[model samples]
Target: MIDCLTGKILKKTPDTVVISCGGIGFAVQVPAATGGSLPAPGREATLYTVMNVTENDVSLYGFATEDQRACFKMLTAVTGVGPKAGLAILSVMTPEKVALAASSGDHKAFTKASGVGPKLAQRITLELKDKVGKGLASGTGFASGADVPAPAGAPAQAVAALVSLGYNTSDAAQAVARIDEDLPVQEIIKIALRSLSRT
Candidate 1:
């Protein structure tokens, strides 16, 4: 039932982070997307969290944003998708990409995540396609070109290319915005690839 945590980050590993609040330290597993954005140790951080209870153990999963936490919840709601699996999915794809994959029935994208099989990907798309649109739309959807400012010089053209390549306007804009203004289109794509690879 723990919905959130606000504390100082005491420690961090690839899969988990320890946060100190009051007099206690709480360890929470996090997806790579959230982990990448975490502040260095000793910095104040806040995470939206979900508590999972089993007969033998209790664990907490944390996200950098409510959108991520909500996506985690939605992923776990599917049959055969547990917390670990859900985290794996989020670790590999952004919430926007995930929503797009589901809504567009792109099982191949889902299958790219570690531990997710083709069948599971298909099932996820089939089961959650309708539900994902609302979540995806909640924050400008996956194609909100406005979220990420366009790069200078041929910015318009780059955005058009991204749109043609299956990315929504928003996703394309964010990806382009992450690149240097002077970088060429190919370099921009490379940078975006590196960023996505980290996820």
Candidate 2:
């Protein structure tokens, strides 16, 4: 039931972070979208959280923005979707893109996520399309300007590589956008790796 957490970032990895609050450290799994926005370790950050409880384990998922958290909640509500799967979807696609894909019945886009298959992708679109509009209207879906930063120069090429590696277009674009335009290809790759690891 923890709605949010504010603390010093103690550690970070591609998909996980440890935040220290009140002398206790909390490990939170986050989507790539949220991971890219995180400040460096030792900085203070706040994340909206969704706590998932089960018979055998408990996990906390964190989001950089309320919109992303809302999207996660919506995604997990589909019958066959679990928190990890929802995080995988968010890691690949932004909430806005996800809404568009669902509304437009773009099963291919939905299936681009690591573990999502054709049937589940189609089912996601079928079950979530109508609900997506509500989230969009409420401003809980992806905002128009919400984008990850990417590095500079040959962005299109880098993005293509990332897409080939299974990252969705939005994620690739954002990661590439964060790079400086003058950076060399190797530097760009390094930055992108750093960005992806935050997820």
Candidate 3:
């Protein structure tokens, strides 16, 4: 199995990238965010990759981070979710948001993806909820983004506030979730911002 690829980017697109390693160019499909975050063509970059093989087809998918690759593995492990659908979900929502949605049982959040319907969205949440919860309880964030429950109330408001200030949703949620105790909305936002700024 190909664990990852590190090479000069020969081409980069929203859904795929061509990385020239040694004397070969490997074309790997990727989520929009991963493609967007990668260095421009000709620059050296690394992608955590998973190769999927079927009876007649072989495909490779890549991610910018190990967490994202782990997220993809967990997503595709679902009964009805395919590789395309998994990338679609990750393209729109980061791993942190996926964990947040599962933790809160917010199936509607995933409906924003292009091909994701309510039923599939609900299944995704239901299947991953246990994994997320167990990972949090075990203090392991390998697949899930956080090892804690998603913030709510003042913390939720703080997350929104951070998002409005141009922070990424994943970053905002994680920062708020890290604050163990409850605080006022302002305090939550303040602490979250401080946490985010440091990252």
For every model shown, the clashing-pair count is 4, 15, 0
Task: Please name the candidate that would achieve the greatest lDDT relative to the true structure.
Answer: 3
lDDT of 3 by residue, 1-199 (tens): 9999999999999999999999899999999999999999999999999899999999999999877887788888888899999999999977766766764567888898779999999998788776664443333433344422332345556655676788765566567666743578898778877887888
Per-residue lDDT of candidate 1, residues 9-92 (tens digit) = 999886799998887899999998899899999999998998999999999999998778877887898888899989999999
lDDT of 2 by residue, 8-78 (tens): 99998879989998999999999987888899999999989999999999999999877678778878888
Candidate 2 Cα outliers beyond 4 Å, as residue runs: 133-199
Estimate candidate 3's alpha-carbon lDDT, on a 0 to 1 scale: 0.77
Error of 3 at 109 (Å): 1.2
- How many angstroms is residue 38 displaced in model 1 relative to the true structure, after the best TM-score fit? 0.5
Candidate ordering by lDDT (highest first): 3, 2, 1
Q: Top TM-score: which candidate number?
A: 3
lDDT of 2 at 25: 99
What's the lDDT for residue 7 in model 1?
Answer: 97
lDDT for model 1 comes to 0.72
